[model samples]
Target: MRSGASRLDLLAARDARHALLVRHAGAGHPALVAVALNVPGEEKSPPGAEPLFRWALDQVIAALPGAWPLHVGDDALGPFALLASRAEAGGAKTACVAVEASHPAARLVDLDVYAPGGTVVDRAALGLPPRRCLLCEAAAGECIRLGRHPLDAVVARARALLADAPA
Candidate 1:
């Protein structure tokens, strides 16, 4: 299958897993994390994405006190997976947002903390800065809004950044 189709399939599977987790957890919150890439093309699982994802996950585990390893999906989709854990004090959404804000690769990681009722925790409510663009220091939303850079340029910049990241 083409990479785009494969990505959709992976996403669908991830959603199913999330639903299952919700059903099983009853009232527990869900922490969902995935790798985010700048460009969309044939290369979905870029060179450094898996390592970066793993590293980010490790950081999340360390930050969330009393975290438990529940389900770890395959790295077929560049380390896309979910961690079902309950923190000691703050809710799961708080813990997930904390990890997103503090991770070194915050630009390349998409971490969402979901409430037990399935609502996502608002990053804006937490007062986190807008995500920066992969190619430029500008806000990512602004760059995409203005089409400030070509896809190739952004992809190249992201690749270079990943290259420098320790595997």
Candidate 2:
């Protein structure tokens, strides 16, 4: 959360994201891509985070054709960009997953695909493997749920990844 956003603010941001998905879907876009940095800790929009967010947005734009931004702004969670895509939901998800899994720095960005009616097209639904942990080979969700890594370590790793990212 940026500027000490409360839990309620975060929840509101989540709701707004869902609303964006529904709006795009209602407009006949088969899918929507929500891009946000996977930076750890409360100061999500940290000093160097926005550039990485922009990089991630560029990567998504390059990877998926016919995808264009529907919304781009900051939220309680941090900087985010939403894209509306005409590609089938499954295909759009697959392509987004590819973008996320393509590089180490890319893993620092979450590119989620949402179908019509605000249904998220998750990797499992498409039979893709779960995302791996930033610091280990274990599943990312599992590591996160278990609090397997210290927040500072995760943040440091994220910074390293960002530092190593191409210009």
Candidate 3:
């Protein structure tokens, strides 16, 4: 079994492979959607991670009409690799942000949308607000950029959020 830290590395490699697959498929703009977690230790794939990821993917699929799935990989790394053919990357990203915002486990789970080139699609480009901190109302980016909170605190809050999620 891969350690949680190594799982992240594996996820990066998988992402590169998916990008190549997207290019080979001749899709104008493919979207790679996955879960984002605020894990503190070497336990990236927590208990509810996969379930939350699947729920988020379902929402994205519903929002993006006519999106054809090109690839689907459910791994132990808690990264749900979903590549879909979409007309506009921005639209797909917007839908993903909406799902993240509406989900009960929104704080603990993140639905990230990546463009064909392997770069993450920005939520701001789609007129979405910056992601809020898992523990507070501050922007998540700011907290991360400044290392404002202890890792343990963030992780605990994430666990609590996951615990409160609907079964």
Candidate 4:
């Protein structure tokens, strides 16, 4: 895949160790993003995951909260910035999630919660720590950004808020 979309299609995602989920209310649109790792000994695919990732973004977005303004994303930072812009422009709230892999909430995406666009944000803005994955730990060029908590943590909180929503 040449772009984020391509990255999604090309990725044969394995289970993630954890994940986080955030819930936003009253937003025009809601979306989820994840980042996955490439197994060490495994061979490489094409350049970027733009197309595959973008398409997957759309699917993931559809699976989230809001009913309108459906959107997909690649190039994690840029898209998220756009989301922030869109929400601000439209005066809509966003549910930011961080699910950890160590818990049940991280079960989505088989615990990987892998998304190209979302990963960069948590890494760049939140100060995520080093990855526990052996492949990432050993790789010299690998990026261990998005030091935020596992996806399960985020998902648990979001689910709680959603379950107890006002009647």
Candidate 5:
């Protein structure tokens, strides 16, 4: 895994239980950080995501049930603004935390439901693949056995356009 991915793992481990509040209404959406699927620096994302990155936040929102009130961009940072709008639309009040990860699109389903403050899980969160780098079975086996944490890699990235943009 890349250094960023490793960092993401650490964060996931730390915040696996904490739900970054995005769109809360009495009980807004809470999510975990998993950015293993996203690009580093988020060259594809808006300015903030390109540098800061909030992969899990976006992922969690996508995984949520009801349609959000605001529009979310395919790029990063849009999620935050969208979530804020959704919260108001839902008529619920809650604090939302912006999440970031090196692995883009990584998320934890029902994070707040599982652990409100935050929880520590095993290596499965690390996002180890089934194989060992296509050549190293040992490494792969270790990853499966140890299971790495998934949060350390990503930091929240917001878009400049959305930074000032309202929900």
Candidate 6:
């Protein structure tokens, strides 16, 4: 909650996401898709974010017709949805990745694919290159871990990306 402003909130959000995966995995879904916007700063649900999140969710649904929503709502961590799908984990990951790579705004949406065992299906598992940074060609995770960019700068870039995105 609180848009992960503190460490505890971030942990709580992570736990909540894991719980979603576990709950759906138990329901016999072969794969699960989790969607959430990558808005920077403590203000995850900033103005304009929810609508962009909705658009991204719609893209995911269109990509995976077999997927059905298990949960869809906004919280301290911003707009998010968890869906259980009959799609195979690998194929689902591929589709989600395609969505993520399709547009700049799409890149700001985290479309995670999960296996029935509650483990995320990473890009490496599908032989895809790691995601690139929003502002550069470096791996996104590496940029995040190294603090290669300022928070405000990332936020501004995100805003610009969202502005260019289809409403």
Model 5 per-residue lDDT tens digits across residues 1-167: 22334555545533431233222323433322222222223233443332232434444455443424332223221122223223322122112212221222222111221112223222334442322221234543464356442322322321222243222
- Higher-TM-score candidate among 2 and 3? 2
Q: What TM-score would candidate 1 get against the native?
A: 0.72
What tens-digit string does per-residue lDDT give for candidate 2 at 33-114? 9999877877777766787788788888888888899899999888898998888889988888887877778888898888
Instruction: Report the CA-based lDDT of candidate 1 relative to the real structure.
Output: 0.59
Off by over 4 Å in 1: 1-27, 30-40, 75-77, 88-104
Stretches of candidate 5 off by over 4 Å are 1-57, 66-114, 121-167
Clashing pairs in 3: none
Give RMSD to native, each candidate.
3.7, 1.6, 3.4, 14.0, 12.4, 1.9
Local distance difference test, each candidate: 0.59, 0.84, 0.64, 0.28, 0.30, 0.84
TM-score of 5: 0.23
* Ten residues in sequence with the least summed lDDT for candidate 1: 32-41
**Count of residue pairs whose backbone atoms collide, per candidate:** 0, 0, 0, 61, 39, 0
Name the regions of candidate 6 deviating beyond 4 angstroms. 1-7
The residue-level lDDT of candidate 1 at 12 comes to: 72
lDDT, candidate 6, 33-151, per-residue tens: 99998877777776677778888888888998878899997766878899888888899999999898887788789998888777789999999899898889999899999999998
Better of 3 and 4 by TM-score: 3
Off by over 4 Å in 3: 1-26, 30-40, 74-77, 114-120
User: Candidates' TM-scores?
Assistant: 0.72, 0.90, 0.75, 0.25, 0.23, 0.91
lDDT of 4 by residue, 29-119 (tens): 2233332212121122222323322332343344443423322232312221122222221112112233223222222211122122333
Q: Regarding lDDT, does 3 or 4 come out ahead?
A: 3
* Ranking of all predicted structures according to TM-score, beginning with the best and ending with the worst: 6, 2, 3, 1, 4, 5
